[model samples]
Target: MTVQINTDKNVEGHDSMNVYFTEELRTTLARFEDKITRIEVHLRDDNADKSGVEDKRCLIEARPENMQPVAVTNYADTTEKAFHGALDKIKKVLATTFEKQKP
Candidate 1:
């Protein structure tokens, strides 16, 4: 599958990038890499100028065949946490969609 990652600013290293893509979503999803056509990830800092409890926001949009594009958004204190939250939402959505398509 094609993976597209969008961050709020420049990343320090590949470790951060990997965390956002692989480790953060490893357990929650099935064999999604092969089944999914494309994944669009949008990471942004909400309330960047102000201090808050949870200001990081991650939005992920997954497009697959014959079904509506699954979009999930999450907010947390850290980028990794937000990504995990969004991944969980996407996993549940995909599972339900696939189950419905099963004969």
Candidate 2:
């Protein structure tokens, strides 16, 4: 599946970060690769230019073949934490979705 990462103005994105996130997403969702078309990750600083306890936000959207897209968002004190949190949420969502298709 194709994975794309986006960041808002408050967040700075780099090649290494993109590569890292891409690898993580690929490994995490490898099972659903055939059924999933694309995965988009959006990261932002909720507090804008200020610092806060939980200003990092991560939104993950997954487009599944022949189905409406599913999305999940998470917040944490750090970008990494937010990403991991959203990742966990999306896993549950996808699992539930695919589970319903079981015979």
Task: Name the candidate that leads on lDDT.
Answer: 2
**Using alpha carbons, what is the TM-score of model 2?**
0.97
Model 2 over residues 9-88: C-alpha lDDT tens digits?
Answer: 98889999999999999999899999999999999998998889989999999999999999999999999999999999
TM-score per candidate: 0.80, 0.97
Task: Give the 10-residue window scoring lowest on summed lDDT in candidate 2.
Answer: 46-55
- Clash pairs, candidate 2, are none
Over 32-77, each residue of candidate 1 has an lDDT whose tens digit, in order, gives 7666787778888877767677788889888887667989999998
Question: What lDDT is obtained when candidate 2 is compared to the true structure?
Answer: 0.95
